[model samples]
Target: MSTPLLSLRGLLKRFGETVALDRLDLDVPSGEFLALLGGSGSGKSTLLRMVAGFEAPDAGQVLFDGRDLAGVPPHARPLNMMFQSYALFPHLTVSGNVAYGLRREGVPRAERDRRVAGALAMVGLEGFDRRLPHRLSGGQRQRVALARALVKRPRLLLLDEPLGALDAGLRERTGFELRALQRETGAAFIMVTHDQGEALALADRVAVLEQGRLVQLGPPRAVYERPATRFVASFLGGANVLEGQPDGAGGLDCPTLGGTLRPAGPLPPATTACALRPERIALRPGASGTNTAAGIIEEVAFRGDDSLLLVRMPGGAVLRVGHAEEDGAPPPRGSTVQLAWEAAAVVPLLG
Candidate 1:
């Protein structure tokens, strides 16, 4: 395989008694969009800072195209970062802000102007150059920040919560624009975000971190459907993890469901648990078959596009089931219902 565009090997960082990053390693191929996903204090931001040359790693290496960046300063590194705040100069116009980096590097006036215009056009901010930061909408400011980063033409771009400042509606729209821009540029991107939907939708591969450890790294579907650990399953998709023991007859003796469930796929050795996504479950009033269970509807939550039904099984374990709005109104609360799913929907998970 060709060498990756960026690599982090045995990277470690600490803040007094707290371990910010614990010997984490990752790689990003050329032109690939990788999302560093985790909650606060999961070391995602610290890792991004390390790559940007703001925070030096306590141990290991940050390699870019086979070059070690140990002593490189942030500006000297062959990369640019877009901050969550957009960080545009309030006093400067959009054109000025986008050209700031090029001017600092002493690029010729003509070349800088051409590059700035091209970058702005790439981000769909063609005629907004003279507008100051405060005059533009939130999304426009985000694009201006992106234009500034792209103007540098860095081999790798680091985005620190690029859409965090936008409202939910604007965030969704800007997310689509961000993905399109990345594809058009073909530049490697490493984005730090805690939003699971954003990570799954935008990233080619997601690197999940927990308490400074790299827990999972793979394509979004792989990580969501075949999570390597219970934490990953719960974190990525909020899957219902059911603890069980293997029955002698190729089935899982799950106490949570009050029965044995035979998985369509062979269980890995020592597998003692499984994950089932709420959306994979089919709920009805009188469904009965293999992998079927009777339950009482404890609650129903309508979420516009879909509804969530909480069902209490015979064993008193409440399982969430997703009901699409197109399926018509869901059974009312306190109604007796049946929850059924395919054997293949039961994903074996490791603890």
Candidate 2:
């Protein structure tokens, strides 16, 4: 296989006694979109800063292509970073902001202008060249930041919470646009985001970090569907984690559900827990079958596109079941219903 476009090997960072990154290692292939996902203090931003040459590691290496970036300055590196704040100069016009980097690098006026125009057009900002940052919408400012980063034509781009500043509606729209832009530019992107939905929606692969350690790394679907650990299953999509004892016959005796669940797939050795997604469950009026449990509806939450039903089982465990609005009105609260699911829907957790 060809070498990865970027590689972090045994990276370690610390501030005072708190460890920021604990010998974490990762790789980003050429033109791949990778998201670094974690909550606050997960070392995601620190890792990004290390790659951009803004921070030095106490141990290990940050390799771009194949060369180490130990002593290189941020601007001297061949990659650019788009900050979460957009960080456009309030005084500079859109074109001016995009051309600042080129001017600093001493590119000729004619070449700089051509590159600036191309970058602007690439981000769909053709006629807004003269508009100041204050005059543009939040999304427009984000595009200007992206264009500025792209103007240099770097092989890799680092995005630090690229959509954190946008409203919910705008963030969703811009995410797709950003993905399309990444494809068009064919540049490897490593984005640091705390938003799980954004990571799953935008990244080709996700690296989940916890307390400065790399917890799990995989494609979004694989990570969401078959999480490697209990933390990953609970963190990514908030899967219902049921703790139980292994029955030795490829089944689990779960006290929470008051039953034994037999998964279609073979269980990992010493498995003590399993994850079931809320959407994987079906609620029936009256049902009695395998992999089924009766519960009373504790609450019904009406989301815009769908509803979430909280069911209290006989064993006192509350399970969330996602119900689509298109299926007509959901059953009222206080009603006893049977929650059924296929054996294949249960995913065994490592811890």
Assess every candidate by TM-score. Answer: 0.96, 0.97
Per-residue lDDT value at 148 in model 1: 97
Candidate 2 lDDT by residue in tens digits, 1-351: 878889899999999999999999998999999999987899999999999999999999999888899999998999999998999999999999999999999999999999999999998999999999999998899999999999999999999999988999999988998999999999999999888999999999999998899999999988889887888888888888888999988888889887767789887889999998999998876667678989999999999888999999887788989998888989999998888888988999886
Q: Model 1 segments beyond 4 Å from truth?
A: none
lDDT, candidate 1, 1-351, per-residue tens: 888899899999999999999999898999999999887899999999999999999999999988999999999998899998989999999999999999999999999999999999898899999999999998899999999999999889999999998999988888988899889889999999978999999999999999899999999999988888888888887888888899876778888787667789787778898888999998755777678899889999999999999988887678889999989999999998878899988988876
Lowest lDDT sum, 10 consecutive residues, model 1, at 283-292
For all candidates in order, the CA lDDT equals 0.90, 0.91
Which whole-number lDDT from 0 to 100 does residue 165 have in model 2? 87
Candidate 1 collision pairs: none
Candidate no. 2 TM-score? 0.97
Q: What RMSD, rounded to one decimal, does every model reach? A: 1.4, 1.3
